[model samples]
Target: MNKVLCFDLDGTLINDKNEIIGGEGTIHALKKLQNIGYKLVVSTGRLEHDIYYINNRYDLKLNYAISQNGAVINKNKELNAKLLDKDEALNIYEYLKTTDLRVELNTVSNRYWHTDRDPDFPKEYYDSSNIVHDFRNVIEYQPAVLFLVIGESDKIKVVQEHINSNYNKVKAIRTSDSSLEILSEGISKGNTVVELFPNSEIISIGDSENDFSMFELSKKSYYVGKGSCNKATYNFSSIYEALKQIIKGEENGQ
Candidate 1:
C-alpha cells in the first residue's frame, strides 16, 4: 500500500464556512496526489455526519477520514472502525459538569453538548448539536471524544492537571487558548496514522495547535498558514499551493 497524505479538514482543506477557496482545481490536486501514488486521508474534529455532509456538498471525494480528533478512524470505506470506551467517556462527562465550561461529547451515531452560560458560542453550534438534557444514558452511548471550551487559560490548565492526576489513561490537549480536547491516551490524528500505517511515509497538513501532534509524527509536514508547529517540513498559504509544490517536485524527479 502507498503512504498517506493526511489533511486537516477545517482551515487546511476548506474554510470555516466549509468552502475550499481555490475552486475545482483543489479537487484536481487531490486526484493528482492519488495518481502520484499517495492516499489522501481527511483528518478532523468533525463527527461522521458533518464530514460526509461537507464532502458531499463540496465534492471532496474523500476515501478515508480520521474523525473526532482521531478518536475514530475510517479506512477502506468502512466508517468509525475505532472508538473510545463509553465508561471512560462517562468519567470525563461527570467530572466536567462540576467545572464552568461548555462541553461537546461525541459518539459515532450522535453528538451531545452543554453550552450553559456560554453566550459567545456561534449560532451554527445552536443549530448543529443536541443539548444535553439527560446524561443518564451517556455511558451507554459510547462516546468517541469529549471537547470542552474553557474561558480562561487557568481553566485549561485545571482540566489538564486533572487529567494528568486522575485519568492518566486519557489525555487533555489545548486546541486553543479557550478550547481543550480530551481523548484516550495517545489518541491523536498523528498517532492514528502511525498506528494504522506503521511503515508508511506520512505527510501531514494542518493549520493550528490541534495539528501539532500530526506534524510531530509525520515523515514530512506541510503546515498551512503561519503558526508554530514542531517539525513542519514546509509552510503554505493553502492546500492548492502545497499540492502544486509537491507535484512540481515530483515532475522534476525529486
Candidate 2:
C-alpha cells in the first residue's frame, strides 16, 4: 500500500518570518522520500491565496496542498473550496469585533483585514493579495477562513467558547496564547486527509495546538518541539531531523 506524509506549515514548517527553519538539508531528504514513492502533502491553516504567495515568496513546492485548515484543497494546481455561509460569516465577524485582535479573513481569491498598522499580523501577506477593506463591501456568501491574532488568553478563551456555543457551524482553535484560528466545521487537516486517502498509511508532524486534530488522526504523529500538549507518538527537535531519520531508514513506511 502507498503511504502519505502530511505536514503542518505555519509553526511546524515556517516561522513567523516565513523562513523555512532547519530546512537547509530538507530538499535532499524530501527527494529521498519521493524516490521511495511516498506522497507529500502540505497541510496549512493558510487559505489558498496566501499559500500561493508564500510558495512563490519562499520557493516552495508540494505535490498537493491543503489550505484553510482543509476548507480548501489543491491537487496538481487545481483548487476546490468549501465556503462558509454568509450568515455564519457575519456571526464570526460580529463575535470577533469586540476584541483588539487583528482579524484576517481569507478566501480562495483574496484576503480581507485591517491595514498593515498592526505589527503582529504579517504585512507582507496583506501587501500581496486582494483585500476587502469593509464588511459591507465583501462579496455575498464567499468562502473564507479567519485568522485572529492577539488577545489576552482568558479573553480569547471566552471568545472561543462563545463561538462554539453560538456559532456551531464554525470551530476555533487557539493556535497560540494570543492567536485563535476559525475554520468551517467538518473541515480540518486530519479529516481532509482521511477523505482524500482513505486507504493510505499516514505519518504526520507538527508543532502547535492547531495541529492536534491532524495528530489525533495519524498512524504515527511526531511533535516538532518540547512542551507540546498534543499526545504525539514521538517527538523530534526539528523537521529536518525527522525527515533525515526517515531517509536513513530510522523509520520505514510501517
Each prediction's TM-score versus the true structure:
0.84, 0.87
Residue range 45-159, candidate 2, lDDT tens digits = 7656666665666555556788777878887667788777677777678757777766777767566766654565544453545545665446355555554555688888887
Error of 2 at 78 (Å): 2.9
User: What would the per-residue lDDT of candidate 1 be over residues 1-254, giving only the tens digit for each residue?
Assistant: 45788888777887755677567888888788887888778888776666777677767667677877887777776665455557776777778888877667665656666544355442232244667775548657454555555568888889888876887567788766677877778788888878877888888888877787889988778888565544588888888888888778768976
Looking at candidate 2, the ten consecutive residues that score lowest on lDDT are 122-131
Q: After superposition, how far is residue 19 of candidate 1 from its true place, in Å?
A: 1.2
Model 2 CA deviation exceeding 4 Å by range: 49-61, 123-126, 130-133, 139-141, 147-149, 250-254
